[model samples]
Target: MERIEVIFKQIGTALRIIFLYKIVFLIACFSITTGWAKTITVCNTCDIASLKKAIAVAEAEDTIFIKKGTYKEFNIVVDKPLTIKGENFPVIDGEDQGEIIRITSDNVTIDGLFIINVGTSYTSDHAAIRVVKSEKFLIQNVVLEKLFFGIYLEKSNNGKVYHNKIIGDAQDEYNSGNGIQLWYCKNVIVGRNIVQKTRDGIYLEFSDNITIDNNISTENLRYGLHFMFSNDDVYTNNTFENNGAGVAVMFSKRIKMLNNTFHKNWGTAAFGLLLKEINDAEISGNTFEENTVGINIEGSNRITYHKNNFIRNGYAIKVLGACYTNVFEYNNFLYNSFDISYNSRINDNVFANNYWSSYTGYDLDRDGIGDIPYRPVKLFSYIVNRTPETIILMRSLFIDIIDFSEKVSPVFTPDNLVDERPKMKKIK
Candidate 1:
């Protein structure tokens, strides 16, 4: 019995020794396969002075730390996974030649770089930084100036663009490009960016599942934020101000726009928000102040506009035609030239629980609901739509008399468009 016990103990000891050897062998193989990632410094007096040279010799998953100096290089391609970091925001002056950086590999990050003077080309859209078909990429804390297109993302997904400032000196829309453009991208987040003076501040085309939050888009020559054929996107807490037009969401469905401010976007053909061919959208908690038109709707259906404040606008909500099943509830319309303007006599929308500053109806029930229904559509607005020159007499007593008569017996505007449960006070 003693001899058998010794034999079993020796067998167990041999198995333990073999397991330890296997672990050591696996560690050696891993070390050989993935060499340690190293940092390559680029400076004027360093061995690698130029950014192109640093990138040429860099292995995958390496860090290229560029010191503070001007690098006059263009069309620099990043074809491997590398983090190109700049200290004190190094300047990459393209000298009006071509694109500054083009990222084509996955898991690449471009941080703390100031890029300028991207080439202008009518045939191709030149950009300061362009990410093409890259995934898991990050572009943050970068400044772009004097660029044709500031940061362009083409067919890229699962990326983030954060805290970048893009300033352009765009004079015309025909020759200028957008600040940050996303084409055919999905699952991208654009946050905390300030884009100004571009043709369009931020433009998205054919992109889906995008989150655009906390962005300030101002002073653009065209729309501050333009969306075309992009669906299932949400833009929240953004401020669009002083642009030619605030925002245009066209041919998109299932969009959620919440807590955004649109202010001072005034022009003859300007509006705070334009919705065309949009469906199943939610627009809530927005403030539109001092704009030509607060919201312009055309051929949109199944949208909900709730908890919005439209103050001191030329027209609060202008319904062109073919808008159906839309609900405007719990909104405050204050001191507008015209509260609602409908070009069509047919209305299939619901207006409920809204507060109008011009409402004279009494609330006898004391339940915070007005006793009488308020009709928002005025006859003068309809006349002005047909003969825009008649808008000159908007404040005249003659226009007021005609508007009172139409309220009694509606003829030009949609008769069914009345807030049944009008709120006595403004919604908080």
Candidate 2:
């Protein structure tokens, strides 16, 4: 039969090459869902003379509308999935030649821009807006000034940097700039921003599940919000003032500091919030005003300082030690010159039911909770904790008669670290 007619002509040429590969994969998915994303407008009477020549003749969901001019242009590369508008705020000048807008692509978009000269490298990290190795991106209402790094987010992931206004007149931390940086990024969503005099107004190093909400980081020269080794992050209602030590949560792990506002952050080693080696944190409803040191807990341990409010601080909490088992409940220790400063007295932490406006304990039968037991670890704070030069005679009178005889014989400060149940008021 002539070899059965050559095996039916090789099965009819394998069904005509599988029907022409399903008609070329359905016309490349119908040319990417029928449109390939259009809208490519640019003014001063033109179509594509600039804006990186309409992003090299746009494609991936195109849209590069630029109207108002001033484009001295630099290294702009929006690899695809585009949408780069600028109807009135277009001024992307990077004549300094470095990074003005270098997004590697993935659903990109940048609104009303104003990125300025950003090129002062010491090996390179230039940016006005650099979202390298991109993922879902969308940087809104941008206005990054004379920057060396602003709105930078390398190795990105689900991004959405909103309402950006990153100012950077950086002077120190090695030649400035960092108003919105997230390295090794993750689920990011830095919202409602307003960063000042840059140098970390919103920085996160090993970013993870980030969500810095309602931001208003002020006068920055260092840390208005500098997150290190980030982990499961979340800082709500933020307002870290006077920067230079306002908010530094280092070596993190499962943190969630809420309702933030740590004021002033004065010098000579300022701090209104600095908890190193933190772990399992949950500092709630925060507000540590007039800062000098209103929360500088080091070598942190199992943390949870709830319902916070510590005003007039020069020192409202400075606990350093091989800290263990932390938990200071229902806080509010107003009017501080020094409310608690421990170095160690061999004690575990648990300052309960707080509310100490200089507790002089006495609420007998008051039913509200203060049946005596307030001792917030003082005794000239254990002689400034073993002679920190005796803190300049902590207001003489022989250091208040040895802190009133260690508050009437309790010997060197940690008599079971009391605070038993002293909240007979103030929780508002």
Candidate 3:
């Protein structure tokens, strides 16, 4: 019995030693991962003055804090998981040499830096900040100016670009680049960024599952928000104003655009929102005001436009054919020149429970809906679609007479295209 007790004591001692070794090993790993992380300061008087030198000497997960000064550097590459933060908005001037900062590492954060003067190269898309093939990255509170492409995310996923201001002096589309561009990226959130005067304010190609929210994109040389071949994207509470073309979504599916404002995007060829070959999208509670065309849809299907306000647009909704299974319900078309313009006489879409300012039907039953069906498309609109020069006589009495006569008997407009439940008052 004493020998057995001695043996059990020996076993317990061995287990205790193994557990102690494991605890020590875990401590060593914790030190390598987090406890040994240090901060490197960058300034003119500091030991590591240049950002490139600081990044080169930084260990993994170290922080590089840049002080307030102008550092003329370009082609700065971050190849490790590090935090590059600035105090009082340090300026990193690329001096028109090349790309400012390129992050090729995951779990990196770039915060509160002012980057400028990205080189203009037709061969390459030089960016103020570029995240390439990295995941779990964050770029916030960065100000970028004089850029070719501002904040370009290339094949990066699970990133957040927040509260950045990107402004460019792009004169021509061929020579300039987009302000914020996501190429082949997925699961990204671009929020609260103000981009202006660039080729396109924000552009996405082959990017999926992106959330673009509360961004103010205006005065771009091209579309304010343009995406193609992207799926499952959400754009909410964004303002697109005075762009060449406000927004364009093409060949995308399952997009949700809600509560956005498209205002003052005016040109002969410009539109507030252009949808081409889009499918299964939801557009709700948006306001399109004073645009040349409110929504220009072509080859789009299975879209739901609900509770939107189209105010004083040249053409509220212009369908250029091949649009089917789309529903426009509870919308307010207020004082648009032409409510709906269709090129084809065949109609497969439904327009129900909308309020039109030009609806002349009365409600004798005292309900909110009108008694008679409202014909939204006019013959003069069809004529203007064919002959653009005839828009000069839009307010003339001759045009009104022809429109009245066509309303009496449907000749050019689709005969079955009528709102059966037109609202007497504008939808709130």
TM-score against native, each model: 0.92, 0.44, 0.92
| RMSD values, in order shown | 5.6, 13.8, 6.3
Number of the predicted model whose lDDT against the real structure is largest: 3
**Which residue pairs show collisions in model 1?**
none
Better of 2 and 3 by TM-score: 3
C-alpha lDDT score of every prediction, in listed order? 0.95, 0.86, 0.96
Tens digits of per-residue lDDT for model 2, 54-102? 8988888788888887887878888998989898797878977887778
Task: State the lDDT of candidate 1 residue by residue for 42-159, as single tens digits.
Answer: 9888999988999999999999999999989999999999999999999999999988899999999999999999999899999999999999999999999999999999999999
Please estimate how well model 1 matches the true structure, expressed as its whole-model Cα lDDT: 0.95
Backbone clashes in candidate 2 total 0
Least accurate stretch of 10 residues (summed lDDT) in model 2? Answer: 41-50
Candidate 3's C-alpha runs over 4 A off are 1-35
For candidate 1, the 10 contiguous residues with the lowest summed lDDT are 29-38
